[model samples]
Target chain A: MRSWKNHVRGELQQRDQTEKLPFIGVFTSLSQMEERFEFRKTCLDDVQSKSLDRGGREVGKDTRLLQLQLRESEHLAEKLSQTVSDLTTVLYLKEAELQYWQSRVSHFRQEALSLAKGSNAMKATLSEFEYTVECQSKELAALRTEQKGINQALEQACREKEELLQRWMEEKREEADRLNKYNAAQERWQRFAKQLKKHLHNARTKEFVPIVTSSWCGEAEMSTSVIQRINNTYRDTTMSKL
Target chain B: MADDKDVLRDVWFGRIPTCFLLNQDEVTEREAEPYYLLLPRVSYLTLVTDKVKKHFHKVIRTDDAEEMWFEYEGTPLKWHYPIGVLFDLHASNTVLPWSITVHFKNFPERDLLHCPSHSVIEAHFMSSIKEADALKHKSQVVNDMQKKDHKQLWMGLQNDKFDQFWAMNRKLMEYPTEDGGFRFIPFRIYQTLSDRPFIQKQFRPVSPEGHVHTLGDLLKEVYPVALPTEGGPKRFQVVIHGIEPLLETPLQWLSEHLSHPDSFLHICVIPVPSD
Candidate 1:
């Protein structure tokens, strides 16, 4: 009886160690604990039956021993009840902890799903933007090339216009210089013609007066005609200047 | 010869090819031919108009043909202004003749109707002149007749003196006759400038002086209503090809800065922060 009690105590100690390992270890140790509980119940029943048989054979001598055995069995029953209560308390705590962990995992999963959806939307917009940027850049390059060609043509036209204007100015200056020279020459010629006309008139009056009184009418007419002819020639030349 | 510097040289005038009709409805392309007048530069437009009238009378034999006036591209020309000034203002070259249209006096609405033959029209016109002449006294008629006959006395006057005298006395001599009307005619002149073409541009009003307008004003004038208004501020950029952006510049200076006579200007506009 003493050895059986010691064995039961050792078994209970082993179950406690197994239960304390972790929540996962608790499930494996649950079947072992049940087996030990059943063994303890049967051992108590056998010890009670042996105590009854010994009381009938040696009533006076086994009375004190039987009473002591009764007290020890009661003590063992209290210890088993305490251990069972402790195990129930451990199971409740483990269940509550498991429920909390499950809720946290579900919340994390939902957050990940939402973040993935947002990433997909951003990627779609990014690709569209990239395509538009590429097309615009190509168009810009073509436009720049055309603009360069136009600028070159404009520059050439401007240069040609400037050159033409310069040439026109030079020609105008030459014309003005020629006009001034011609005007000066015309003034000199007019003065010389006037002096020549005066000399001819004086010569006719001073030298031909006596000749004219004689019958030299034909000579006088010829001189006058010659003078008129010369005057006509000078007038014609002056008119041409205009 | 004394006023030779004031003489007009290389002047040009325009003549309508056919007799002008008094009715606006009778105007046609056939009469639109612009003939170059071969008059001397010193000759006045009045001489051109008189010559045109004589040619029409000689060719058509229509005694009651209405009087005509000259218009250049719809602007009526004054009879006294020298044709040279007109040529200078409109045409760069002196030789090219101007284009003109001849409009008749009160034809479509009033005169020159219901006449059958030349004799009847002549008789009617003669009776009107006789009636007008009879209304004046014999002494006044003699004085007017002598003045008309002695036009050659003043014909050799210088152009400036003649123009001034005519400008002042033209209204005095044009007194209404017994028929309550007067006879007047105009002659148009044109000269085409092939080498130097004139270009004019009007800007949108922007300031109190009315010289400049914003760039948006130009865009609005060009495109009637294509822009959409948003709640936010709208910004746009203009890019002129071969030139810098033309923002915040005075509208009066825009044409001078961007334009040359020979080259074509290209412009581009872009909107900012498009949604």
Candidate 2:
């Protein structure tokens, strides 16, 4: 009995030392210790009862029952130890699955941060493209309006050129007509003067008469004076006509 | 006076033989033959040159042809002038069948007005009539005429319908009996010796002293140089419709009988032929 008590006290000491495990491990170990304590209490009761009976046949039957109880307790202890090992394996697997999931979550977080930075850069580029497009469109519109204005001015200039050409042609025609008339008159006057000069030369040559100074000088002199008067009258008439 | 009505018929029916030959520089599809026509003396050149234009267009290429203009002796013929005036001014001394060059290019833009269509001729004719009426009756006679009446006058000239034109023209010639004649005789004196285009002035058919004005008196007042001095040789021949009327003809009589379709007495003073 003293040896059995010593064994139970050693088991209690081992259970108390094992209480320093993790929270869930400590709880499972404490439950297993309580079951062992109950089993030990039942075994102590059976031993006491057998001591009290003391009859030879009764003691033999009690010894057989105690042996069967001891076999049952050993089987139960083996099954509990297997259950504890299986629970420990499940905890280890669960911890490994948690570690894998935590690593995946961290990887996803890093990817999300990189995606956010890329999106910000894309947004800036998009806004710059939009701003540049707006400026280019504004410049195109201004150029289009300026082109229209230049076209209108070109058309106006063309119209003015046509009008100026018309006016210039009119003035040129008038000047040409005046010049033609002046030339025609000049030609006619030139021809007329040429004819008049020929007429005067012919008249002077025909009036030329040689005077002979022989006897009867007074008669010849009077005849020459009469011829001179006739020639003078002819020259005066020609001059008046001119 | 009854014989004077025949003068109008004679003037209207008067024609001049013209031969149109294409210019040497013009491009032609084939050899262009000369076209001949008897142009009316009273009508405009552009008005009566349709046949001439068609005849020339037959030989000219479509792309090479341009506005048709007439040239005579290197002088661009003014289409706006009456055919007789142009003939007497530039071609009276030439032989029969006055030779005119047909030009399909190089239009004399500086010398001649463009006659793109008959409308241009119509407008010019109507304006000339209006100007004459203004001088004769101060525009009262023309203003009283209906639009159709004016159109009839133009149509008559265009179609060579003398009766149609005379029907509307007699009304314009009318004047008050007490006035003895129109308010003023519209006359244009064209001299070959002067730089002026023509001499136009407001002169009454009768003088204020009640004496009938004469053609000689009009010339003396407007262009003294056109007349000959006393006992001086004749230097200028005052011609009207290819003939010289006696200077003693009354101004009103000339305006009524010798005036052109536009109702203007066109007197061309040319130098006397030396021959």
Candidate 3:
């Protein structure tokens, strides 16, 4: 009986070790435990029948003890199966949680990759914008300098125009003065010409009346040269008086 | 005046039998059949040639096609002009069933305005009406009309509904009885001899002395050469709506009866057909 108890203990220890091996090993060991319990039950039945036949009180007590030990081992196996079921449930839950975390990790990795690509594109765009700004600023500076040059040219042209205008006005003023002087001289010359015309008409009438009166007195033969000399002397006297 | 109302109906219902033939140079998958249509004289060519386009489209490759244009003999037809004006100006003396060559390439940009779509036609038509109103009523009548009324006029012409068009157009033709006629007659005279497109001038329907102006008077004032010299050969024929109306016909009556839907008297002065 002691040896049987020791063997039962050793079987329980082997089951425990098999349970620690793997899930399949635990199932195999469970089947082995069932087989051993059946065998031990058969052996107990045989021992009980024999003890009954012999009508021995101590043998029946031993058989009852063996039955008690077998019952205890069955109780231990039931408890161990409950623990295995609980451990399987915990393992399934842990596997699900690990899968969920792995998927989350992959999603974060994708997000990080996309963010890196976006940043690279943004950097390129920013550099392009900066280059355009630099080119635009340079063009603006060149335009400003060109505008300044044009302004100076325009100012110089304006100054030259003003100078030319002043010179033209002075020349016009001088010409106007000369015209005024010439007009005055022309007026004086006209007056002198009018007086000379009147004097010539008067002298011609006076000389012609005397020549007509002398010709009427039959002085036709009186030398024509002498009349011409008289007329010349009278015109010279009229000019000197003017 | 009662007899004159028939003339307006006759003018409105006038149609010309036209034959549309594809040009020889166009790329076609098969021999294109000629399309025959009774084109409305008062409408535009581009507005009435949808069937012609479809018939030709069946035989022509889509990849080689461009904006469709038309030609007769050799001259590219200007689609902006009324079909009747185009006929009277170019094909007045031609044989029946006016043959026009359809082209899908080589658009004559210098000779014709691009149609693009039906909206362009609408815009052109509306602008013409407004211009005529400006001449007739100082633009008072057209401006006073509602948007739907204007749409009615366009829709009536587009759908070939004479009553619908006339319902809105009658208002544009009204004038004070005491004034005897419109403020000015909107008229354009086209001649084939000159490089000028047309002659447009401000002309009154009545003389200052209250004498009613006649078609002859309008022609004499604007183009004296269009009239036959006394006891001389007729050098030109003054055509309106494919007929030579008597010179003594009152200009006001002609304006009321003979003017196109655009409200303008388009006169074509073509050389006398020698044959």
Clashing pairs in 1: B98-B190, B206-B212
Instruction: State the weakest 10-residue window (summed lDDT) of model 1 chain B.
Output: B1-10
iRMSD for every model: 62.0, 77.6, 56.6
lDDT of each: 0.42, 0.78, 0.80
List-wise, what DockQ does each model earn? 0.00, 0.00, 0.00
Candidate 1 lDDT over residue span A1-242, tens digit each: 24422332343334223222233243336435654565566666665576568757534546655755666677679889987975675566457546645765786688788889999999999999999999999999999999999999999999999999999999999888878877786787678778767866875785477575776656656767776887788789767876
lDDT comparison, 1 vs 2, better candidate: 2
Quote model 2's TM-score.
0.52
* TM-score for each model: 0.26, 0.52, 0.53
What's the lDDT for residue B231 in model 2? 100
Residue A186, model 2, lDDT: 59
Off by over 4 Å in 3: A1-242, B1-3
Give lDDT tens digits, candidate 3, residues B178-273: 799999999999999998999999999999999999889999999999999999999898888777777877788778878899999999999998
- How does chain A of every candidate compare to the true chain A by TM-score? 0.46, 0.42, 0.42
What DockQ does predicted model 1 obtain? 0.00
TM-score of candidate 3 relative to the true fold: 0.53
Question: What RMSD value applies to candidate 3?
Answer: 42.6
Docking class of predicted structure 2: incorrect
